[model samples]
Target chain A: MTETRLTEKTAGIRDVAARAGVSQTTVSHVLNATPHTRVSEETAARVRVAAEELGYRPNRLARGLRTQASEMIGLLTEEIATTPHAGRIILGAQEEASRHNLTLAIINSELNPDPEVPPVQVQAFLDRQVDGIIYATVYHDEIVAPENLSARPAVLIGARDSSGILPAVLPDERAGAVAVVEMLVARGHRRIAFAASAEDVPATRGRLGGYLEAMAAAGLPTEGLVAEGSSDARGGYTATNALLDAGPTALFCYNDRMAMGAYRAAGECGLSIPGDLSVVGFDDQAPIPESLFPPLTTVALPHYEMGAWAVDALYAVVSGSGERATSFAPTLLPCPLVERESVAAPRA
Target chain B: MTETRLTEKTAGIRDVAARAGVSQTTVSHVLNATPHTRVSEETAARVRVAAEELGYRPNRLARGLRTQASEMIGLLTEEIATTPHAGRIILGAQEEASRHNLTLAIINSELNPDPEVPPVQVQAFLDRQVDGIIYATVYHDEIVAPENLSARPAVLIGARDSSGILPAVLPDERAGAVAVVEMLVARGHRRIAFAASAEDVPATRGRLGGYLEAMAAAGLPTEGLVAEGSSDARGGYTATNALLDAGPTALFCYNDRMAMGAYRAAGECGLSIPGDLSVVGFDDQAPIPESLFPPLTTVALPHYEMGAWAVDALYAVVSGSGERATSFAPTLLPCPLVERESVAAPRA
Candidate 1:
């Protein structure tokens, strides 16, 4: 057994090689597990033992420079820092990247309509030689790919480009909305009010489509049930007020913020949640849903799942083996329903 | 002007050198703005123009390899991704790093009692040769420095180690609490009840200290005015119930969440916010404070500023200048008060 003293300086491969009584090439092959090396098992075992004893850490940057693969993935996001619930995407990607022994480098760009690639960020990532890139968004939207992004394997999370060139991973918003209505229907909500988001947003469109689809399937009239609003608390309040005129037993909101607004509206109308009215929300954003009077029953966007899948897809592309379909095949991960105290059957 | 057609391949430094009719060293010096390079201004301009014409992008990784400074800073955090408000730390760091032409790489570790540095993440950053590291916490707490972290320049954000060896940037919790009470006092509320947080947390201690200091300065009675809670909505509700018995006209909560609970408690007691009783909170965490009936008046954590400062401090350490004091000088950035609708003069 070799006694190693803790030192401020990190041990290098040369130290391991000298300690192991082996050549630097032998130490490299042993440490990297390089295939078809001429070194014997005994020599490899000695090298490993010496390396462990010396606490020798491999300089990955130097090795990556030679191999042109850093085992690092870049997560380039817009407004992720400011977005309420989008941080999970970075978490999901980070966890998955770690699982594959890959480091995820996150770069947040300013939220703007300009389509140009953030030159500094892209250049930094390129300089780092990140094996692949995951371009994620705070919301579901169409985007223009940064020029030369194709130089490295790339995938999109929560969004896609107009040309649909890169693969994407997104939450199944349509299915999520359908599930919300289906749950309400099961709870005996016949006259359901949909507090829809703005008409231009993709989530609003997808969720509204699902609301209409479910309404038709249940043989219920969709008219006067859908009220449009900006995806916010004030919008929910206004939409719920209008929907209340038609009298809805249940209100399905665009997102949790709007649902919070719905709660305020219900209070204004002298109604109690899950007593006089049952409410459902989407995106299940935290601190909002969980902190509500009676925690909100809402759809949890597949943020973590989408994030994990984005890395997996990017990895597949980087490895040059997996189903890296060139065409725009936006993979939709399921949005699971989080059952809280908000949902209840209609009044007797 | 020479018109260059876009090509699939990225134009290399070699291409720029050839186009500009300059040596590779001259091209490198001109592109990198390397100091002390004797290249004529005319030649530098010619090189820049040629490089721009060919869309030449310098490989930063290659340059960093020789320099041993990647201009990358690692942000190792625990639960920043899951935490509701901590993502701003990353944004602030990213923005600051960008201002210096550096890249911020984020790594989130699982929240656990064990304070071991995430080995894989540390290794990855080491491999990437990040010039420095900023170790940030989701919430303010004491932490253990990762082993041998001193090998590179590092700073702590929102936290500190037992040894206090590293430079730390933290929100001024004590001052924040003092400010909260001062705001209530300025509003002409004499009877202020403090819904305090748990006894053990550092924030609770710091904030309570501030409360006492402010109350002493105001010559207000400190006894029977402080009610301790678990720093949640339920805790706030419970504490408010006890404090209300004291017949206080205003309540100061440990956090926005507790303030929310105070609202419910106030409602149950037939009181309206700022109408019957005024309320103030700390850590103006979003959704809770803002979404309240009247937005809660609270102190905003200097998360963005702390993050930006951490990077600056780390940069100073990296640059080997600025007071990188060895002794623990925990830099407490000011927590500014954010006024909203929740505060008003106590009813006569």
Candidate 2:
């Protein structure tokens, strides 16, 4: 229990300007992050340092009443308890929010609880006067957000708004799968096998579709080259066993988990990775890819990118300097290939 | 990118009380979460529903100005980017905060940078006027917190504060380790080996200490049984291989990653888990324990419990209903053993 508050006198704009040896207008632009402002990095850093030293916190509530902006952004994420990568998204959003002197407050929503009504969590953000809302959903390809979300600048991540009114961003899972196949083909592997997941999630379809399309484009026969698994390490092991029976020289797993199984399967068969058999995976899940013996070469999802993009876009809207979404198409951010020791040329 | 404000008119506490057929005092006690008050769960539920129906939100700023409480808690975490379970901590704190009608804001601190000065992130939270702060660190056995942290009701997770004034909660890694050894000994395993970590962290010491203590109690010879590894899969494999030379019938890894390597070493040596040589791990890392075949039996770090405890403790202090920490010792929370399929009776 705190006995007495030790915080010093709250500093005002004039105090910050005087401390930084800058004009009040300059302090305003730096702290408020006004658009189209030209302040050198050095001067901006000085102003921020001065503000921190003087404990000058811009009265966000009062300022919101004056400028119709709260300088607070709300991120509504779904299933953070299960999704390991959700932290990455939060980190990106929080750091980017800090860069703009905006506070990023978060609330994790239960997994797609209701389809008929908007979540009450959105109203809580509005209660706190958040300037914008970013809803990150994974259960749906298209989501209908709370009608009141439009009352403030809002963006969607991992799903498009079915109303086609809100801007959205998603990872290109299909493209990432395709890239993995292409890389394997370039590595002089003709019979590249796929360990497909049996689950019916969006990613399963996207990844399988890419694998099939890439194989067809490479003029490779799919006959006996695809095996379905349950999307875990065991599934990978079983499916890789079947695919190995087909005499494939390379394996492209549905995800890093399956690739883990593939590694086990390969070790059982006494085949060294990147030498006797090349392997690749998607969804470069943390610790998994790096913890593997030879390490795994997998495709990384654009979670951090999506989080940063939402803030930058929302900040623009709040500053009245950027366009709102008018198109229904969701922007698919690239899933970059992370090469490690997993993929290599097939032996003669 | 919002076109217009569509949020409905705000509802006050009077309106909620009228809707719920309760007095304003009841509504205040329920919504403000005032301690030392008698309110039935049914009545609280009715009040909450009425508040939600009318889209009512108490003006936190106005109320805070009068009550000297911000209704906001700041959580500053270390190495959220790498600590896989940091999200668990955030989730627990957040859910608990919501239950108390408080907003939880988070700022992730980079790992152990500039050990002398207080992290600026704390000041950012202070600037916004958080009623309390929760600092979560894993790098230290005991740390000197920012001197000003005493200005508010503060709690620490994963480490003890040097000042001994701030209440802190830590996982009982040693107990968890001791439990595993005792469990194995109960299963008639006398030659159990430990795949120890080479990392110089608090966990490494705690876990090893528990194992050595437990083995001594069990009247088992640990000579030539403990082998050091790099704290990853490769390290586990090397350590297990060396330990196996002593003909141990069971293995305990420092963490999950090392257990992964132990699995590989077992597989290569033609040993079946829980059939020939049982294995256990610590940390219960996401995806790893479950992904491993035979599923690892391991210890959980009580991350969620710590997060929830910090919030509950802080709320008590804020409400002037709980004891402030005057002890130099940290509270050790139980690290529960999550028994999956990896452990079994050692082969006779």
Candidate 3:
């Protein structure tokens, strides 16, 4: 055996073949366990022993370069690492990728301020020749497609292009808001106050639309019931105080953080949850909803499912098996309600 | 341009060189904007125009294969994507890597159950020839080095190997705990109660040790002042109730989450914060500390800085510029206290 092959750096296939006293093809067949390779059992055993001795690992990249394929996917995320609760997208994608025997390479684009798809990371993915790419956003929004993203089959998670040309997976904010109101109304509450998220956010529009639709369906008055605030705990606090002055028996917050703020606001007003006022929240972010005094009842963002579906869609596109569209509409997944202690029947 | 070069896939450097009537090396020098390259202005302009016309991007992998270096780092994280607040590690690492023109490829090994380093991810990184690997944990703990990890320079983040062989970057939990207690003592509060974290976690031992040391230094009684909890809001709530019954004027919680619980408990007992009871917390986690009614006075985890330092250490080892030890000692960074509305002088 060559002294160089025994070094700490991984031994190559040529080294294994040399140590085993066999051709490189024979070693490859033996290591891959390729069917019908006609390699004898004794030779296979020798190859295995030689590989173990030399610490030989199959060069997956070299193999990929030869075959023009690597069972790997690239995930490009915007602000996921810096933002709260969005890392679940990466987790979901990783889980699904593993099930398909594909590894995921994640690149966070938060460091690059350029709105364009980060060229460096995209170039890296291209150099590696990933089978597909999934572009994810920290929050639901519209995105301008990067100029240099045409190399691989790509899909969007939690976002969509303005031209509607990209396949996108998103949470059904409208449905989630409808569910929250339906649950609250069923608990014998009529005077419902909506603490709306900021106007510019796409989720705010969808959630408000759902609230308006639900209120109209129930023939409940909507006048002077909507309180505007940013999508944060402080916003929820300020909005709740204003809504309380108008006398809402129940409050529906834009998100769980805002709901927590409402909890503190209720305490200051000398009101107890479920006794004098009931509360409902959206985006059942962990530790926050679960740690609340009453354990907030909220809608779960379909982040995990969206991530999984994005992978599936990207795989289909890469495999050329799914229907191809010039301009695909956004695929909306359900945001189910997580029942907890926050919501209760309105007081008599 | 050839028909293949005009396809959606990125055009190669050869295509640009052929069209620009220049050598591949010249094209590379022009595209990379290398400072010392002697390419003429006319030649550089021609290379740029050809690259733009053909949409050519240099293949980083092919270049890496030639140079035996990819200028890429692999980050193997356990549960960073699934856990809260830990993603900052990735963000910090990413920022530092970018500054050095090194891209980070992240793979979450938590999907794999084996305690050893995840073989698949390591193989992928090997295939791509990553310069180094950083194995990070979601929380501080001891880990078993994965087999076949000797090929690349590696370091641990937020964890240490049982053999003490791998260089580790960790939060100074003892120092953080000591700082918290010292700050409280300086405020003239001698009757302090500790709402401790779960006993099994490594942070718990360090924090408890620091608390005991600080109390002893202050000549205060430590017995009957430590109330154990599981490091959650509910645990804080339960432990705080027990501690308050002992007539303590202040409470130090294991974490921000637990401090929140303490707030609820104190509220239920009709005690106002700082007015009747002062509270301090560890791990100044976002939104939780900031959203609390009076805000929270807590110790910062130094997650971002630890991540940056780990990358620096790994780079040093990879470049052969720093002292390399078989069993390196743990590197502990400072955990400074963040003063906010939660801490105050004890009631007269």
Candidate 4:
């Protein structure tokens, strides 16, 4: 395709008016796609042609009032910096937003909200006049709408309750955990330990429940194998050490960060991954899995894909097409085990 | 602070003018902060008060033309999906831009730039009217500037050689490399290996130079240990295996991705980190130290700080306060060794 010489600096509506032998106001009305115009269709088309030839791009924001649409969505992510899964979510949301030619105005609150603290900084989105809002929760919790947020259409990501007040998209945490356990059992691993975080968050409970359900269904012992740790590596290290003391051959981690901590503790305890203690991790968004000591045997959750699905759900709501909760599903992507150096036959 | 009751409606310049008892032209001049206006100080204060009270936000792009400033910076990231470090850069730039009340327009090319692409499509930023541009390259290469980009003030990040044309802010690759090697050597490591991508690139060359310099200073042999690898975990793994074959007690990787590869190789070969082989990596931005089995002992480059600095440099140029390159010491931020489980005393 021959490159069009559309210079950054272009003549305004006055230039178009002069070329078309019409008033500047007439040219602007045609350019703005104004309603209730007395001008004939043929005349409007001529003005549009002249403006296009001049490469006069209309300012969408300025014309938003006329169109009642800015074609922009505001994404408010809580604790983007700290959340390990947020990167993929943002990436997915951006891709979907761009695909639709809609701009995403993203704002992240790194601070995790205390119960007493205000839930969100909704004012930013309000000020921007965003067409819709996607509120991605840092941790799954009871849906608490900050007072007076009902004016705009909004969607929630990772909400514990979907009362259908607004549409919500979340990962099927229970199914993900069950899949991880089933994979290890299928691999002939009898002794399986569940390493969970100390935080009593909804997502953690769901994951823990899944682990127990899987063990019960498989007719295996769940006692003495479940250990609690912090959300970070140090927590994983301590939990792994305790789990090892009880002599579990296979360890299932709640998340990638905890898995890393388990890796460190195993190293210190002289237990080789797969060879000694086969490790399986959830939320395979971490960059270290490919390079982990025994490239980790992880059950990868499609975090980015989930985010993309959320975007699609939000788009449906904003476009007035897809039904509220009907369009949104708690997407349960099957967690697949990434077979690497992490799993091997149990040491004799 | 009492939450301000937001009145949900579009408040325009005309509303502010009527409330202030001033002309629309006077309100525009006052909002633009335009000089050469003989409006009384009291009148100007009244206009400002009216604008604030009525919530009259100026249309940025149109006013940008009148003032010849957008108060916005355009950030061109090399890739947003793969390189996690680029996200940090975006965050830093966005934070700095927001602090200065400047909006940030980000465009990410996943590094697949085809020369055949038209200038208008490639330069999606042209319509945005950004006052300054920060071109953040994930890898070092000659950027094919958009036709007539020289007219716009820009700063390149992650690569120097602005080709004596535009300003640049780059991480001191040589210094970063030297620092990692020095840390490994201080821990009584002698046979240290340097693993990097194909050494033709500027970053690879600079890092290689530092490795050689450090080896010479330490009076250690540089033969057979320096190996070329890809810039990802697989490359790091292959290069590390080669380095191990060459019998290096310690390893210095080009970046975290490469270091991750080394970590995997070391695990596969039954080598415990720090005990069997000490490993150090670069660019501690993402899930490197925390995600690695033993939190990696690697260099943490200021990717976000560089982004902030790049914006500051561009601001200086746009504001016409400082020279093209505010300074050229390359901001020698010593990538301090984060002593995790990765590095240990070389086995005697």
Candidate 5:
């Protein structure tokens, strides 16, 4: 009711503990929801009453130190400013961060110019004093380390060949690619072509390699298969048109964009998806599989798990209870072919 | 080279300053390129020599507070989980962040869901102690204050009505839509249709409103215009297909994904871009515009400036040099019609 009430100074947690004649530890236990700790009901009620009256705010920094825990984690995204799927990764990371009572501070390593720890950035983290670091690359490659992160625990998301040095979480990329190719083959398409951009990026390479491996592993002809496609829908469209010239019955795309391109090109060529030419995509991103007149059946990366595992690893370090570098076996969460109106038996 | 050597504790700036018999201030001045502060040639040389010998790593946080003046800005993204253009916003923010010698720490508000200030996330910033906060919302709205942030300086990015308390940097939605419409109109398209998501989102509403304004302003018929698209590519595609049935010769999509949908539907309808139907899009999102067979002609948001400006505005408050709640007129950076194979004159 009073104007001064709006600007009154709030009391600290220490004040409440002092007023209730309880230790700061007890107040923290009550606030943090630490179960199994017993306190008399009357005493708890008294403490709550005092805290409510005083409007005491907790100093998380000091509390975190006492608990030997920091409810904060670092999320380092690779190719953040460039990749389309980066949004999904951040979303998954946020979901995981919420579930674990951890907050994330994101850094775009893409702009660092240097692959290793840019000195300036390292100091920035030091100033903020993050509990753990999660280095995420767009797709995955062997992520190189920056200088001086030994004191702080860290985790890697995406493709980093960890020889058991630090914890890493990567997608079942090879399996995803294989699933797409196998689906195309099941549709009775013999001459399947691959469309992808930049053969150098790990995910691109992995998908392409998986296609080849799946084809060869299945004894399908490797001749005249695979086209170097760009990482966008337009590139996919162009590449599909080019591959069609070679008389391929079906196509496996690197990512969703290229698959969208193939959808357009196929439509332009008057070829029915899965009826004349079956199309499969990797990295089931937005709109492509769902927005396409026929929903796309593409490989879905375990983005959510990658974020969750990375945080778990970080927390393990904070608790000093987990393996230093835990390597999670890539779990393929089925990129099973979603049969829509898209695929029909390929016309001979 | 011994592997153990890499683990040696690196010398800090203070160590170098002590060794050089110089004040930390002089060392900072030498490193930061400040002109007004004077140091003798001999003293400068000695300080440099000492710094080099000790392999001094400057404390970026401390140095930033002094001579460097925190080029680092905080880009506080709202709910990184569900936003469409947040990654692009981050990209623009990063580009601007680096251009200004400022680094960005993107924090997700979703991690903490406090009505006043979510319980989990605020501590992440407090520990890091970022110089300024840039509150970036995917859609514009009033900002709910995070607890204990009254002392912190911050700017609102992408909020239209900021309640006259926070400096806001948002996309000039109307101008952007106008630019897209103008490009289509200039290319000789008359029957233009608009595809947008829900009107609840400020961005979508502004862009859709801009499209209508541009249409009426250009004396074009607003009949049969569609604004029932979602913010995804599939939504764009479906909306575009429906609009095509209305016999529109050109389409101005809400975002790139919608344009992408148009591309697919166009293919399905055996229509050639620019030849049969022309399309324009907003947001030059990656893999969408570039991956398109003929790269998309779309309006791009000044994502980085949004971030950089937010930081600058926040700094104005932190430095106690500016008024609270400054407003940045949403800028329209001339969405230069990226003359691609998308749009052309209506078929003769």
Candidate 6:
């Protein structure tokens, strides 16, 4: 009620400056929260009150034209709904953009409709004159950056630009798989089995490769234990059922969906999770992990971290500040393992 | 690449007009793809080719200042990452926005911190001079519209504004529940049990209320049939276990997570789905419904529809065109049933 009454109409910067006994420049600096501006706390508070009392609403559009900064970042993400948890990436980017007082303008693209650069999508952002652009995708390991993307400072998430022009960030899928294996090995499970995905996506190779490297490092043989299946529950079920014939006491799935199948397989075989046959999965995806019977232990992709990192990197280039990473290898954010009740020492 | 060299530097609209042998207004109409323009296809093609040839990028910021249309809408969403498949909502809105040639500026807010309107967040959008604002929340049935939100055209998604001023759209939760029961009854399950969530969210009441109303209308007696548990898998498991003692032939869970638990309970009781027990769930949430061994028969909230609707509604109001719905009750989109493998007729 008070807010409705207090907020009537706009009072220009001049009104705020005159009311607060400050220059219009000071009012703009204080209201915009301009960096490197030294305004006393006492004066800033007075300016805010005066502005509020006068119903002063700063017009960023007018300011943007004068300053040549739209203060908007465009995010073009691919196949958002199908991905396990793309929302976290968006959430991370949106929040970090908010922290920097920049608005995130988002566009959803079809899942890599073709190998060609999405010049039309990039052009849309350029038309709006977004200060920077962030291209996010889960399907690709390397992408051809859109030609017009170079028109502004840009960043990539979940995929690297093949040309090595834009700074990029992605989850360390190999490292996460290694961590999962090391944890299981520490629990004394030498007969660990891997349920690999049939899909040829980058994640499949990264995860399987990590498993092989980690098993080798632990001086354990994976002969006849690494089975391939579709990267979902049914695949997990079939792979686990097949691997069970080898009498492995533990199973590691390519993803949480596959782990769901492993659990079902265990149930059918009269095995209790972490008791008779311990199981673990990757992509500690929401609802899947926590909703499972014993809450399956899994590795979490650094989706949120990557999203946040992209914005920070883009902002750095936008403002021409902050330590900008050289474009070479994409920054690999850690995919940490989340422990739940699904993993335990294999039954003696 | 041809695209890089072709997109080298900017060419003013005047240059495109001169090259295309058309006026600047004709070039603008064709390039902006302004609705209802009468420019012939040949002329439109020529203008586009000229603009492409000269690399003319339209300055939306300068155009916005002159025309007072930012061509942007701000979407303020609450607890985006935690919601079940909020990305679908985003995808729907974004795709629709793209169709209208409008950019969707998004900001994710923490789950409502208080009943007090989030003036600061609203102010941020207002600062950017977004032509309209869309406030989306899953936690509330109705909310107080922020004070300055009235400064521009606004719409609500997932919740209604209490003041009955701003137009809103929400999923038909109660109707969705009714559909589930009717489907079960059609499958010959008279003794259908409901695994209700213990949480106090509006979804709980909306779903449960639909069940009770539908049951009563079907002339089915509500004996010891409804069981309550937490809104997740564990809750579904415990509730399903207890309800099984009642010898119900079918179980309808509050959501898919609970259905997961129901699946577990059926396994423990040695009951084969359809032959001994049939199960159904709401929120045909990704991976959950499809990943289940027999898959799941569930209801899908019109998340995508509502998202698209909000943008269309906002656009209608922004342009002062289209059948602008009068502010009153919230528009309810349908929740359709997605049939997988879990549901079937009970055995004789």
- How would you encode candidate 4's per-residue C-alpha lDDT over B1-348 as one tens digit per residue? 111223556578899999999999999888877778778889999999999998676654445555656566777666667767666777777777766666665555666465345444234444445667777786764555554344467777775543456566676778778877888888899999989787477778878898999889889998999888888788898899888988888888988889877877888799888788888887775676666666787777677788788878777766767666545444433455566778888888
lDDT by residue for model 3 (B156-235), tens: 88888777878888888898888888888999999999999875778888888889899999898877788988788999
lDDT of 1 by residue, B1-348 (tens): 111212446778888888899988999998878887688999999999999998777666777778767778898887776667777887888889888778788788766565575455666677668888888875657778776566677888878876778888888899988988888898898998899987577888888889999999999987999998877888888899999989888888988888988988898788899898999988888767777777889999888898899889888766657655556778889999999998899999
Cα RMSD (Å) between model 3 and the true structure? 3.9
Q: Write the per-residue lDDT of candidate 3 for residues A272-320, one digit (tens) a residue.
A: 8868888888888767887898888888988889888988887776666
For all candidates in order, state the fraction of native interface contacts they contain. Answer: 0.52, 0.43, 0.34, 0.14, 0.38, 0.90
User: For model 1, what is the error of residue A135's alpha carbon versus the real structure, in angstroms, after optimal superposition?
Assistant: 1.4
Model 1 lDDT tens row, A205-289: 8888998899889988879988988777888888899899888899999988889889989987888998989999998887778
lDDT tens readout by residue for model 6, A125-237? 98887988999989888888776777777888888898997788989999999998999999999999999999999999999999999999999999999898898899999
Worst 10 residues of 5 chain A by lDDT: A1-10
Give the CAPRI class of candidate 3. Answer: acceptable
Tens digits of lDDT, candidate 2, A1-348: 254543545678899999999999999999979999989999999999999998777755556545656688998889888888999899988888999988888888897656667677787787777889999886577777778787688999988888888999888988988998888888899999999999998888888999999999999988999999999999999999999989888999999999999999999889999898888988889889988979999999998899999898899888778766657788899999999998888898
Question: What 10-residue stretch in candidate 4 chain A is worst by lDDT?
Answer: A1-10
Q: Is candidate 1 or candidate 4 better by DockQ?
A: 1
* Residue pairs whose backbone atoms clash in candidate 3: B117-B146
Interface RMSD (Å) of model 3?
2.2
Candidate 5, position B18, lDDT: 97
Worst 10 residues of 5 chain B by lDDT: B326-335
- Write one digit per residue (lDDT tens) for candidate 4, span A1-348: 111222546567788888887898899888767788778788888898888888776544445535566566767777676666676777787778767666565666665545345444455555545667777885765566554345567777777334557666667778888887888888888899989989998778978999999999999998999999997777888899889977888998887778888997898788888888999887776575765666787766666776677678778766767655554344444555566678766676
Q: Specify the highest-TM-score model's number.
A: 1
The digit string of per-residue lDDT tens for model 6 on B1-348 reads 323423655678899999999999999999878998899999999999998888788888888888878989988888888897688888888888999999999988776656566567788988888888888888788888776787777888988888888899998999999998988888788998999999998899999999999999898866889999988888999999989988898899999999988888888889987678888899988889999878899999898998899899988877767555565988999999998888878888
lDDT of 5 by residue, A1-348 (tens): 223323654477788999988987787777666799987778788788888888665644455545434465667676776665667666666666666666666666654455565545444454445678777776546655565444467767775644446666677677778876777777677787888675577777677778889999888886767677667776787788778888887777887778887887887778877777777777767545666667776777767667777777778766567655544453233344445556666786
Ranking of all candidate structures by their DockQ, best first: 6, 1, 2, 3, 5, 4
For model 3, what is the alpha-carbon lDDT of residue B179? 87
| Model 6, global lDDT | 0.87
A-chain TM-score per prediction?
A: 0.93, 0.87, 0.86, 0.81, 0.84, 0.91
